[model samples]
Target: MPETKKFLYVNRKAPYGTIYAQEALEVVLIGAAFEQDVSLAFLDDGVYQITKGQNTKEVSMKNFSLTYKALGDYDVNKIYVEQESLDARGLTLDDLLPLAWEDEDDDWAKKDSIKVVSAAEMAKIMEQSDIVFSF
Candidate 1:
Protein backbone atom coordinates (compact mmCIF):
# COMPACT_ATOMS: atom_id res chain seq x y z
CA MET A 1 0.00 0.00 0.00
CA PRO A 2 1.21 3.54 -0.70
CA GLU A 3 2.09 5.40 2.44
CA THR A 4 -0.49 8.04 3.21
CA LYS A 5 1.20 11.38 3.80
CA LYS A 6 -0.11 14.23 5.92
CA PHE A 7 -0.95 17.43 4.06
CA LEU A 8 -1.40 20.74 5.83
CA TYR A 9 -2.74 23.92 4.26
CA VAL A 10 -1.92 27.09 6.18
CA ASN A 11 -4.37 29.90 5.56
CA ARG A 12 -3.38 33.37 6.81
CA LYS A 13 -5.53 35.66 4.72
CA ALA A 14 -9.16 36.69 4.64
CA PRO A 15 -11.48 34.74 2.35
CA TYR A 16 -12.14 37.62 -0.02
CA GLY A 17 -10.08 40.72 -0.85
CA THR A 18 -7.53 38.31 -2.36
CA ILE A 19 -7.59 35.02 -4.23
CA TYR A 20 -5.20 33.19 -1.94
CA ALA A 21 -7.89 31.68 0.29
CA GLN A 22 -10.01 30.48 -2.62
CA GLU A 23 -7.05 29.05 -4.48
CA ALA A 24 -5.78 27.27 -1.42
CA LEU A 25 -9.22 25.75 -0.87
CA GLU A 26 -9.33 24.59 -4.47
CA VAL A 27 -5.98 22.88 -4.08
CA VAL A 28 -7.15 21.23 -0.86
CA LEU A 29 -10.33 19.97 -2.55
CA ILE A 30 -8.31 18.41 -5.34
CA GLY A 31 -5.75 16.93 -2.96
CA ALA A 32 -8.46 15.33 -0.81
CA ALA A 33 -9.46 13.11 -3.72
CA PHE A 34 -6.28 11.12 -3.15
CA GLU A 35 -7.51 10.03 0.32
CA GLN A 36 -4.48 11.58 1.95
CA ASP A 37 -4.67 12.84 5.51
CA VAL A 38 -5.45 16.53 5.01
CA SER A 39 -5.69 19.37 7.52
CA LEU A 40 -6.28 23.13 7.25
CA ALA A 41 -5.05 25.81 9.63
CA PHE A 42 -6.80 29.15 9.80
CA LEU A 43 -4.41 31.67 11.28
CA ASP A 44 -4.34 35.46 11.36
CA ASP A 45 -6.97 36.89 9.05
CA GLY A 46 -7.49 33.44 7.57
CA VAL A 47 -9.83 32.60 10.43
CA TYR A 48 -12.40 34.79 8.77
CA GLN A 49 -12.72 32.26 5.96
CA ILE A 50 -15.10 30.29 8.10
CA THR A 51 -16.78 33.24 9.73
CA LYS A 52 -20.56 33.00 9.59
CA GLY A 53 -23.05 35.39 8.01
CA GLN A 54 -20.94 36.19 4.96
CA ASN A 55 -22.84 38.16 2.37
CA THR A 56 -21.30 39.12 -0.98
CA LYS A 57 -24.41 40.50 -2.59
CA GLU A 58 -23.18 44.07 -2.27
CA VAL A 59 -19.87 43.06 -3.81
CA SER A 60 -21.59 41.11 -6.56
CA MET A 61 -19.69 37.98 -5.67
CA LYS A 62 -20.91 34.51 -4.93
CA ASN A 63 -21.03 33.64 -1.25
CA PHE A 64 -18.48 30.91 -0.67
CA SER A 65 -19.10 30.39 3.02
CA LEU A 66 -21.12 27.35 2.01
CA THR A 67 -18.02 26.03 0.24
CA TYR A 68 -16.35 25.65 3.60
CA LYS A 69 -19.32 23.64 4.81
CA ALA A 70 -19.13 21.47 1.68
CA LEU A 71 -15.53 20.59 2.48
CA GLY A 72 -16.80 18.02 4.97
CA ASP A 73 -18.48 16.17 2.15
CA TYR A 74 -15.10 15.83 0.45
CA ASP A 75 -13.72 14.31 3.67
CA VAL A 76 -11.56 17.40 4.19
CA ASN A 77 -12.80 17.90 7.72
CA LYS A 78 -9.75 18.71 9.80
CA ILE A 79 -10.14 22.50 10.07
CA TYR A 80 -8.14 24.25 12.77
CA VAL A 81 -8.83 27.83 13.72
CA GLU A 82 -6.19 29.57 15.82
CA GLN A 83 -7.45 30.90 19.15
CA GLU A 84 -5.19 33.94 19.19
CA SER A 85 -6.31 34.83 15.68
CA LEU A 86 -9.95 34.76 16.72
CA ASP A 87 -9.28 36.67 19.93
CA ALA A 88 -7.24 39.25 18.05
CA ARG A 89 -10.24 39.88 15.83
CA GLY A 90 -12.77 39.60 18.66
CA LEU A 91 -14.38 36.59 17.07
CA THR A 92 -15.58 33.30 18.49
CA LEU A 93 -16.77 29.91 17.35
CA ASP A 94 -20.28 31.33 17.28
CA ASP A 95 -19.16 33.66 14.54
CA LEU A 96 -18.02 30.76 12.34
CA LEU A 97 -19.95 28.21 10.40
CA PRO A 98 -20.71 24.93 12.12
CA LEU A 99 -18.99 22.42 9.84
CA ALA A 100 -19.31 18.69 10.38
CA TRP A 101 -18.53 15.40 8.68
CA GLU A 102 -19.40 11.75 8.99
CA ASP A 103 -17.19 9.77 11.31
CA GLU A 104 -17.15 6.27 9.93
CA ASP A 105 -15.20 5.04 12.92
CA ASP A 106 -18.12 6.07 15.06
CA ASP A 107 -20.64 4.23 12.93
CA TRP A 108 -20.98 7.03 10.42
CA ALA A 109 -21.97 9.54 13.02
CA LYS A 110 -21.61 13.24 12.28
CA LYS A 111 -18.99 15.30 14.10
CA ASP A 112 -17.78 18.89 14.10
CA SER A 113 -15.19 19.76 11.45
CA ILE A 114 -13.54 22.72 13.15
CA LYS A 115 -10.97 22.40 15.90
CA VAL A 116 -9.95 25.55 17.78
CA VAL A 117 -6.37 25.50 19.00
CA SER A 118 -3.69 27.85 20.21
CA ALA A 119 -0.94 29.11 17.91
CA ALA A 120 1.58 26.97 19.76
CA GLU A 121 -0.59 23.91 19.29
CA MET A 122 -0.98 24.66 15.61
CA ALA A 123 2.79 24.90 15.26
CA LYS A 124 3.07 21.38 16.64
CA ILE A 125 0.60 20.23 14.04
CA MET A 126 2.60 21.95 11.32
CA GLU A 127 5.72 20.13 12.45
CA GLN A 128 3.99 16.80 11.90
CA SER A 129 2.88 17.64 8.41
CA ASP A 130 4.54 15.83 5.52
CA ILE A 131 3.64 18.63 3.16
CA VAL A 132 2.76 22.18 4.15
CA PHE A 133 1.14 24.61 1.73
CA SER A 134 1.03 28.11 3.12
CA PHE A 135 -1.20 30.80 1.67
Candidate 2:
Protein backbone atom coordinates (compact mmCIF):
# COMPACT_ATOMS: atom_id res chain seq x y z
CA MET A 1 0.00 0.00 0.00
CA PRO A 2 1.11 3.59 -0.67
CA GLU A 3 1.94 5.77 2.27
CA THR A 4 -0.59 8.52 2.90
CA LYS A 5 0.96 11.95 3.27
CA LYS A 6 -0.28 14.44 5.81
CA PHE A 7 -1.01 18.00 4.72
CA LEU A 8 -1.23 20.92 7.07
CA TYR A 9 -2.70 24.21 5.88
CA VAL A 10 -1.83 27.21 8.01
CA ASN A 11 -4.10 30.24 7.73
CA ARG A 12 -2.92 33.45 9.40
CA LYS A 13 -5.02 36.23 7.88
CA ALA A 14 -8.53 37.44 8.40
CA PRO A 15 -11.16 35.82 6.19
CA TYR A 16 -12.45 38.69 4.06
CA GLY A 17 -9.86 41.41 3.94
CA THR A 18 -7.86 39.60 1.28
CA ILE A 19 -8.43 36.73 -1.12
CA TYR A 20 -5.96 34.51 0.67
CA ALA A 21 -8.46 32.86 2.97
CA GLN A 22 -10.88 32.04 0.16
CA GLU A 23 -8.13 30.86 -2.12
CA ALA A 24 -6.62 28.74 0.57
CA LEU A 25 -10.01 27.21 1.24
CA GLU A 26 -10.40 26.46 -2.44
CA VAL A 27 -7.06 24.69 -2.44
CA VAL A 28 -8.04 22.70 0.64
CA LEU A 29 -11.31 21.65 -0.95
CA ILE A 30 -9.54 20.55 -4.08
CA GLY A 31 -6.86 18.72 -2.15
CA ALA A 32 -9.37 16.90 -0.02
CA ALA A 33 -10.69 15.12 -3.11
CA PHE A 34 -7.35 13.35 -3.33
CA GLU A 35 -8.03 11.55 -0.01
CA GLN A 36 -4.76 12.53 1.62
CA ASP A 37 -4.73 13.25 5.33
CA VAL A 38 -5.46 16.97 5.64
CA SER A 39 -5.59 19.42 8.49
CA LEU A 40 -6.17 23.15 8.81
CA ALA A 41 -4.73 25.45 11.46
CA PHE A 42 -6.37 28.80 12.05
CA LEU A 43 -3.89 31.21 13.58
CA ASP A 44 -3.56 34.97 14.10
CA ASP A 45 -6.46 36.78 12.45
CA GLY A 46 -7.34 33.60 10.70
CA VAL A 47 -9.41 32.67 13.71
CA TYR A 48 -12.07 35.00 12.34
CA GLN A 49 -12.45 32.75 9.35
CA ILE A 50 -14.41 30.28 11.38
CA THR A 51 -16.21 32.83 13.52
CA LYS A 52 -19.96 32.82 13.77
CA GLY A 53 -22.38 35.60 12.81
CA GLN A 54 -20.42 37.22 10.05
CA ASN A 55 -22.27 39.95 8.11
CA THR A 56 -20.89 40.76 4.71
CA LYS A 57 -24.02 42.28 3.23
CA GLU A 58 -22.68 45.79 3.46
CA VAL A 59 -19.43 44.76 1.82
CA SER A 60 -21.26 43.16 -1.12
CA MET A 61 -19.26 40.01 -0.66
CA LYS A 62 -20.42 36.44 -0.32
CA ASN A 63 -20.28 35.22 3.24
CA PHE A 64 -18.27 32.05 3.10
CA SER A 65 -18.06 31.32 6.80
CA LEU A 66 -20.38 28.39 6.31
CA THR A 67 -18.07 27.01 3.70
CA TYR A 68 -15.94 25.60 6.48
CA LYS A 69 -18.88 23.52 7.55
CA ALA A 70 -18.96 21.75 4.21
CA LEU A 71 -15.43 20.53 4.84
CA GLY A 72 -16.80 17.93 7.19
CA ASP A 73 -18.79 16.35 4.39
CA TYR A 74 -15.63 16.15 2.32
CA ASP A 75 -13.85 14.31 5.16
CA VAL A 76 -11.64 17.30 5.83
CA ASN A 77 -12.42 17.43 9.50
CA LYS A 78 -9.16 18.26 11.25
CA ILE A 79 -9.47 21.93 12.13
CA TYR A 80 -7.20 23.44 14.75
CA VAL A 81 -7.82 26.77 16.43
CA GLU A 82 -4.89 28.45 18.15
CA GLN A 83 -5.75 29.48 21.68
CA GLU A 84 -3.12 32.19 21.79
CA SER A 85 -4.51 33.71 18.64
CA LEU A 86 -7.99 33.86 20.09
CA ASP A 87 -6.68 35.26 23.38
CA ALA A 88 -4.69 37.92 21.62
CA ARG A 89 -7.85 39.08 19.91
CA GLY A 90 -9.93 39.01 23.09
CA LEU A 91 -11.98 36.12 21.82
CA THR A 92 -12.94 32.64 23.00
CA LEU A 93 -14.18 29.39 21.56
CA ASP A 94 -17.73 30.70 22.00
CA ASP A 95 -17.02 33.35 19.41
CA LEU A 96 -16.54 30.71 16.76
CA LEU A 97 -19.05 28.46 15.09
CA PRO A 98 -19.40 24.91 16.34
CA LEU A 99 -18.16 22.59 13.61
CA ALA A 100 -18.60 18.83 13.68
CA TRP A 101 -18.11 15.78 11.55
CA GLU A 102 -19.48 12.27 11.44
CA ASP A 103 -17.19 9.75 13.08
CA GLU A 104 -16.48 7.12 10.45
CA ASP A 105 -15.19 4.74 13.10
CA ASP A 106 -18.33 5.08 15.20
CA ASP A 107 -21.06 4.35 12.72
CA TRP A 108 -21.24 7.98 11.56
CA ALA A 109 -21.74 9.43 14.99
CA LYS A 110 -21.42 13.20 15.01
CA LYS A 111 -18.28 14.51 16.72
CA ASP A 112 -17.11 17.97 17.63
CA SER A 113 -14.85 18.89 14.80
CA ILE A 114 -12.60 21.68 16.01
CA LYS A 115 -9.58 21.16 18.21
CA VAL A 116 -8.20 24.00 20.30
CA VAL A 117 -4.44 24.15 20.72
CA SER A 118 -1.64 26.48 21.67
CA ALA A 119 0.81 28.07 19.29
CA ALA A 120 3.54 25.73 20.45
CA GLU A 121 1.34 22.76 19.80
CA MET A 122 0.40 24.04 16.35
CA ALA A 123 4.12 24.25 15.58
CA LYS A 124 4.49 20.63 16.55
CA ILE A 125 1.61 19.70 14.24
CA MET A 126 3.31 21.55 11.41
CA GLU A 127 6.58 19.79 12.13
CA GLN A 128 4.87 16.43 12.04
CA SER A 129 3.18 17.08 8.69
CA ASP A 130 4.64 15.82 5.44
CA ILE A 131 3.57 18.99 3.58
CA VAL A 132 2.70 22.36 5.06
CA PHE A 133 0.95 25.14 3.15
CA SER A 134 0.69 28.58 4.71
CA PHE A 135 -1.46 31.53 3.73
Off by over 4 Å in 1: none
- The alpha-carbon lDDT assigned to residue 34 of candidate 1 equals 94
Clashes of 2: 0
Give the range where candidate 2 is weakest over 10 consecutive residues by summed lDDT. Answer: 1-10
lDDT of 2 by residue, 3-116 (tens): 899999999999888989999999999999888999999999999899999989999998888888889999988999999999999999999998889988999999977999
- Location of the lowest summed lDDT over 10 successive residues in candidate 1: 60-69
Clashing residue pair totals per candidate (backbone < 3 A) = 0, 0
Scored by lDDT, the top model is 2
RMSD of each: 1.2, 1.3
Looking at model 2, the pairs that clash are: none
Q: How does each model score on TM-score?
A: 0.95, 0.95
